[model samples]
Structures are given as C-alpha cells and as structure tokens.
Target: MSEFDKKDVPEERIGLIDLMRTIKVVPLVTLHSPEEAVPLARALASGGVPIAEVTFRSAAALDGMRAIHDQVPEVTLVAGTVHTVDQARQAVEAGCKGVVSPAFSDAVVDWCMGSRIPVLPGTATPSDIEKAYDLGLRFTKFFPAEAYGGVKTLKALSGPFAEMSFLPTGGVGFGNAREYIDLPNVFAVGGSFPVPSKAQRQGDWKAVADACAQARQLVQG
Candidate 1:
C-alpha cells in the first residue's frame, strides 16, 4: 500500500485543484536550508497564503517539507519539480499533500494516479495538455508561461480547452500576475515571486510575509 493508504486520511478531502483555486496563488519555494522551513511556512500563513510548493531542486527539499509538515501543519505542502516515481514516493513520505512536475512525466503521473495522489503535470503546448486531458486530467500547469506567450497563449488555449484549467507558473511575477489570474482558465498562479530572494537569503521572514501579502492582493484585485 502507498504511504497515503497507511495513514488514516479523510475520504472526502478537498481536491488539490479546488484548494488551489481558493488560494489563488501557490508559492513555489526552494529551501537551501532545512531550518528555514518552519519560519517560511509560518510567514506564508501570516501573509494570508498558507500553501507552499516545495520544489525538489535542492538537497534540503525533503527535510524542509518534513519540518514544515511537522511544525507548520496549516501550510499545505505540494512536492514540486518531481521527475521520477521514486521522488514522488519520497515526497508522499515527506508529507506532501500533492505532487507537481516541471514536465509531464508519464511514470510520475501514472504512479500518482495509481496512488490516488493529486498531480499537476506541466504543459507548455497543446500536445502536453492533450496528453493530460487524455488521461482524464483537466487541471495542469502551464510552465514557462511568459516565454511561451503568457496571457496570449492562455487566451488561445481557452478556445480549444475550455473545460481545462491551469496553474500558470514561470515568469509569473507581480506585474503580470493580475493578468494571468484574470484569465478564465487560470485557476491559480505559481512562482517564487511571493518569496523574495533577498529576503529569504537574509532569513527575513517578515519581508517574506509582506511579499506574500502583496502577491495575494495583486491576484485578488
């Protein structure tokens, strides 16, 4: 059985897509140190956004997720930048509520589906979206959003994939956040914009909180 089955999880839990829609913004985070996890999570919560997509881009990813899960339980955790099935399993073991891949990995998506774990496979083109759609997935991520045409691309996609919703990430910042979030098909925006690099490097939790609040405002407005 999967780790999720080993635990007593609620049967009627909120789906990740619905949760993301409500939150409006999902902060893509990369932790260089495990010690920053709790405070970073706390900051996110204080800023009115209590969700984090901890990317497996560093050695500290699992440890950081563990700390946030154990100490800052209110912050919803999603494993990001996943590339393989093993990493997906390790993410669930670390207490991630969902999984996000930078690209549509057949193995990872298949494993998540079999394990009943929410997965957002990345898509930058119609073909990628079509593959996820064929798998009965209506929610997916639009990666490198700006580079691939940003709002214009999403607008064009809305025509053919009207039933689909997206979490637009990459090149998403305050300036264009409102534009992305305003799109009817965009469920939420994702980026490191909410977690300022300088502030995080300095361990300035308050600045992080403020940045998150500002992002939340921008999207909500």
Candidate 2:
C-alpha cells in the first residue's frame, strides 16, 4: 500500500516513459563547457538517439542545458545527478523535461511531485525501491548497476517489483547494454557509453555520432 494518500503523479510522465522505452538508450552527458552543448546534442540526434541526461556534475550544466534547449529543440533533455531542490528548479527553468537524482532524496522527490515535474529517484535496494513505491512512483533508476550485481540484481528485483520499471545506469556500456535492456523490468539503459570521452573532448562530433549509432543498434538489433 502507498504511504501517500494521493499520488500526484503527472499524466505527462507516462508519455515520457513511453518515449524512453522506444529510444532504449539514454546518454548520460556531463558538460565541461556550455559551448559543446549544441554540437553534442545535434550529434546524438543525427545518430538516431535524440535524448540526453545532462548531469550537474560540472559547473556548466545549466548553461549547457539552456544552450541545447534553445538550439537543439528536437532532443529530449533530462537533468541528472541532481542533489537539491535549487538544482532541480534551475534545471527545469533551463528546459529539462525531467529530474533524475542519484539517490532518493525526500525533499527533492516531494518538491518535484508537488511541482508536477517527472522525477526518477535512484534505487539500489529493496528499501529504496519501497520508498519510491510508497510515494506512488512506478519508475526509478538502478544506479551503479554493474557494481550492484547488474543483470542478476535486476532479475531478483523483478519478482517483488513486478509493477515497477527501471532505468539501469552506472557502469552500463555497449558490451552489456543489450543484456540490461533485455530485462523485462528495465525500460531503458543509461550511461556515458554513447558519448565517448575521447570523442567528446576532441570535438569529434562524427565519432560521437558513430558511437551513438552503434549503441542504438546494439539495443534495437
């Protein structure tokens, strides 16, 4: 049973989940310069994967998000590694369609729920999953997936969390991405694998695009 009396889960969030399921892969992007935003987003789109999870690990996250929002409107943007309500608010203002936290922060979750913003709180254990479930959240992120048993853990979770879906991130890469995506409980896989670090740092947009295309094929193939 849910702990909350009324789950104010927004209707639009369902559409977002459906979109993610179709995409099958989400690029976990961290920007060092806002200038890289437009080109990187365009590369992802050109490669047939038009979604990016711009993490707030860098100082330039907000500016980069704003640039992508304004210049590459076709790409779906979600804020990642968010730690505070302030960051979440800024992310939405910068044009992120949703908020993704690395851990389940009650304040952040409550705020996003009240504001009608879609939030995917990270979960690593049954307790964490229960917290999200009690709040009426059906979708959550399984972080550090490789470190936490990878496909095995997801399989174990499926029995107890039959109605829940997951976005498995952390340590997910091209080699085992399809394995994760094949799980019935997984909606999509998230990682920095699609945007290779060397390619991104060297401003090799074509390499980045090629990496994305390969990743897309790996899952959809």
Q: Which one wins on TM-score?
A: 2
Q: Which stretches of candidate 2 lie over 4 Å from their true place?
A: 1-9
Assess the local accuracy of residue 26 in candidate 1 as a C-alpha lDDT between 0 and 100. Answer: 98
* Candidate 2, 36-134: lDDT as tens digits: 999999999999899999999999999999999999999999999999999999999999999999999999999998998889999999999999998
Candidate 2: TM-score? 0.96
TM-score list, all predictions = 0.94, 0.96
**Candidate 2, residue 142: lDDT:** 96
lDDT of 1 by residue, 126-199 (tens): 99999988887777899989999999999999999887789999999998999999999998999999999999
Q: Score each candidate by Cα lDDT.
A: 0.91, 0.92
Estimate the Cα RMSD of every predicted model relative to the unseen true structure.
5.2, 3.2
Clashing pairs in 2: none
lDDT at 33, model 2: 96
Candidate 1 error regions (>4 Å): 1-14
Q: In model 2, state the lDDT of residue 165.
A: 86
